[model samples]
Target: MDAYTQPRGKPHVHLVVGGGGLKVTDQAGAEKFGDLPWKTDLDWIRERSEVTVSRLAELFGVTRKAFYGWVEGANPRKGGSQVRIAALRAVLATLPSDLHRTAFFGLVDVNFTGDASFREVFQGPVDDASYQDRLNAKLAEINPEIESTVKRLHRASPSSRAFESEYPSA
Candidate 1:
């Protein structure tokens, strides 16, 4: 396992298993919230979440203009909004790329109890490690099939073309 803190003075620690995947952990805890890695690819997030920029901005509690600026290369202010974006990205990264936007948003908007959805619950200042742990637990309870499918996808070749090229006779 190759473990190291994120770059640009970000406080999160990442463990990269050799020839495998990355695992992000909050090594510095809540004290490091100010230094959490908020810089991420906005385009990727937009594509993955499949939501309009306005809705995305609303989700992070920011204005459309501000979100657009961030998408266009401006750095978002370091604070709760950025933390929420980070949290959303963390959750999205766990899901499959091909999942329908409706299903994805449905998961996000499903009521946790009577009054709170995953979106409402994961907002504001959050402890990264605890949040990820809880998210994993919730996902497991909500849809075990998604987990199994993710595992299967990870084990299989991502490119159908690669498979076809390799087995031309089939």
Candidate 2:
């Protein structure tokens, strides 16, 4: 089974258990038994565990800002099947005892993994001066406020005045 840990304020682990059905045993009793019904759907959360911030936020009905808050795991994740609950518990066992919101999901390059760029490859090594220059320009071009201010001055709020003047001249 493979496991992964998310990178955030607190960090959480995603565990992949294999080769056996969900098992449960009371701490007082030594005997093991099959998982109870009603926790089956949690398997989906396990299968698709270890997602990125935006992805997790969308999948788990959490706002992006809410995900950023450093609080106890607030997402109402009740168990649908004991198997999934067991799986979740097993995964939780590997994580820090403190399960905060930020710790619940971390950066895993989770959503965008493929070659997102339209071009075939980067023009140069990431650290090179040319690459840095291109990266800076690209970032500026993609920034919403910067782009709006530059190409579409019309989109600027009527109340917004130029920095140099009380009112910006067209």
Candidate 3:
């Protein structure tokens, strides 16, 4: 007989993920939940029902391949365990102007969401024309100083084309 001959039937293993609360058919099945148990052959989990493959896989470092294989399945899955998305926009709005990284993340969040606050502050409420007019009046109070600064910047700087070319993004 060939030294590398295969065993009779494949090992009797069943993989269950996420605390072994349920039964899984393959390593791939367990992988969706990021759990990979390779302890028993298909027989034990299905036939004997004594020692759960979930508990026995601990003896072997099998979670990697087994779980990842399931992850690669056509309908691979994932389980939630502390995977959090930051509420960056809300947090960033409150940050000081000097903290630019927060500003970047905040901007990203704002871009990610159709945030009403930003739209309200920037575009003004479409339904509230009077409020917009009031806002424009307040903005006008800050205009003279802004105009003077713009004029000063123009006077001190290079040509508009050159400036545009220098900082095309702005």
lDDT of 2 by residue, 71-123 (tens): 11222333222232333334334433232212333321222225333111122
Q: Comparing candidate 1 with candidate 2, which one achieves the higher TM-score?
A: 1
Model 3 TM-score?
0.21
TM-score of each: 0.52, 0.19, 0.21
What is the per-residue lDDT of model 1 for residues 81-144, given as tens digits with 9 covering 90 to 100? 6666666677777775655333555566566446566666666346555766666565545465
Better of 1 and 3 by TM-score: 1
Better of 2 and 3 by TM-score: 3
For model 1 the local lDDT of residue 127 reads 53
The runs of at least 3 residues in candidate 1 whose Cα sits more than 4 Å from the true structure, single-residue gaps closed, are 1-39, 144-170
Which stretches in model 3 have alpha-carbon errors above 4 Å? Answer: 1-129, 159-170
Positional deviation of residue 23's Cα in model 2 after best superposition, in angstroms: 25
- Scored by TM-score, the top model is 1
- Tens-digit lDDT track of model 3 for 1-170: 57578566654556544332345565445444333222222222223222333422221223544433432331213321111001112222333332232222223213222333322333333344454444344334434444455456557867658877878884
